[model samples]
Target: MSIHSYQTALVTGASSGIGAACVRMLSRHDMRVTAMDRDSDRLAELASETGCEAIVMDIRQTEELYETFADRDIDVLVNNAGLAHGLAEGFLGTGNDQVDEMIGVNVTAAIHVLRAVLPSMITRKRGHIIAMGSIASLYPLGLPVYGASKGAIRSLSRHLRMELSGTKIRHTEICPGRTETGFFDTAFGDPQQRASFVSEIRLLDPADIADAIEYALRTPLHVNVSSIEITPVDQVPGGQILG
Candidate 1:
């Protein structure tokens, strides 16, 4: 099956990595893609490359989101903007400022993005919301704050599907593990630190994630792939857990 009806899509954090890959993939499917990100240069480059409308702004500023989507009829909303900080320091050791930033972008901004875009979907009675979640949300590990933020997304995706029941709208969370993206650069600021962590397991590509999202979007309307938990084969969960 294919999504032949959706004419437009809005992807957050769309300047690079998985976001950019999603934009490219959606464009291939003949959608007028809107790429939103804080990186003006990269956004402009992407717009030039794919003819997508690029909106440059900090998603954390919730107020601007209201103005940005005021009149746009977005058929698909890729709620993909997020970041991780202070991996070097555990929760208590991590600075409160870093903690707040994580929550601001990953949680607060994600909600506002949905709030800003979902109205149009509700009015039209059709839409698809794709959330970018992480393995951290499902498993326990070194990132407590980061994991907490993603866990909130996990809950949000479920509740959103519940809320949209009986409608044509669909909500799916893509939980990816060890993907090679700018995420590693932000999470493990130090090159060596990121290398050290990924040394044990092979990493998945950003395109791999975009492929999972494509699968979710292309499914028949009657079928809602609520959540997709994808990870590298070598990178299994901790002992005694099949998840």
Candidate 2:
């Protein structure tokens, strides 16, 4: 029995990394895809390569989100666009703009997109929401604001599942750890730091997270994979010790 039931999927941050991988994977499954990203050039390139509908717009612009998805009927929504501006000194160390940007893109924008897309799904009673979370959400790593944003996603996914319990709608949180997506390049200010971190450990690829998402989505309608926390085999958290 085949469980590939979705017809259309919308993936945010689809220009690169996990989002791009999801676009490609979903397309390979014969699902129509709408790829959204702020990077117009990369979005166009991805669309050309994968035959997806590309939308060039920043997710932080909430007003535009409603207008962009006004009439689209999306079966799967992958909230993958997020940013972590340097983890130098946690939340208090960063400027207000950086904090706002992280919260806006990582948390608020997802809610806006959900508001815009959920009505049709609720009306039809069939949809799946995939939230891109991080291991930081579960295991704190000095980046307070980034962790908080992902924790918000983790909480949102849990509550959303409860809110839509009787309906056919499903929610999943994909929490990935230390992915080799060049995300650390933006998260760390020093090039040497990024290089050193990359060399120090084996990181999970974006495709790994995308594969997990694909599996969750392709499950039978009766089965709901609520959450998946994936990390490289080489990486594991140690127990906290009392000093």
Candidate 3:
């Protein structure tokens, strides 16, 4: 999808996965991109390849998030930095550290980004805010923390949309299920189990999710697509949870 003229897009988790894909696609559409991630090296690499600016900052730090976006004029804000499996197990197993980290990054960090970028957008009367959520939000499962986090995201997206009504600021949430990303391996304690859980499902590609982000941003100015859920056909599981 083609972006508006002279729009700047800020994508969190931009070093890789869905974030990176969004950055690349936005850049291709001639939108200036500020790619933010905790990994400096990977952020730089993505920047070089996509011709975007890279900001190395952990989302957990609110100050860093504000400082990173302080001087920039952003037209689109993609809150895409979050993980679930490890955090889920930790919450279930009573691991406080992991639980805190998960809440910090997935929920707290998103608020920080919104606070950092939203003021200018609302004042200027032009901007699009998108958050990456998951299907876990819709149906409750064993991963209480993760499901809760995504549920918060879903509410946040809808609330923001209503709050921004009668204004140019738009909000949308994209809920994707079972994407084929390194997250399953590197971010989880039992990569095999995680893989096995989704083995029979057709997973999404980073670009697929990215395309959804772009589409949400490119919708007609008068029309706001508040929520979009995307999942692979095989992962539908006959409208039931995978066994």
**Per-model TM against the reference:** 0.95, 0.95, 0.93
lDDT of 3 by residue, 1-243 (tens): 356663788999889889999889889888889998899999888878989998888888888778767777788888999876563255557467767776888899998898899888877888888888988787655568877888989988888777888777878889888788766764467756776765766789999998888787777888788888888876663357641
lDDT of 1 by residue, 1-243 (tens): 138489999999999999999999999888999999999999999999999999999998788899989899999889999999877656777778889999999999999999999989999988999999999999996789999999999999888888898778988999998887888778776788878876766788889999999999988888889999999888787894432
Give the TM-score comparing model 1 with the true structure, all chains together. 0.95
Highest lDDT: give the candidate number: 1
Residue 174 in candidate 1 has what lDDT? 94
Clashing pairs in 3: none
Q: Global CA lDDT of candidate 1, please?
A: 0.89
In the range 98-194, model 2's lDDT, one tens digit per residue, is 8889899999998899999998899889999999998889886777889999999999988888889888898889988888885777777778877
Better of 1 and 2 by lDDT: 1
lDDT of each: 0.89, 0.86, 0.81
Off by over 4 Å in 2: 1-3, 240-243
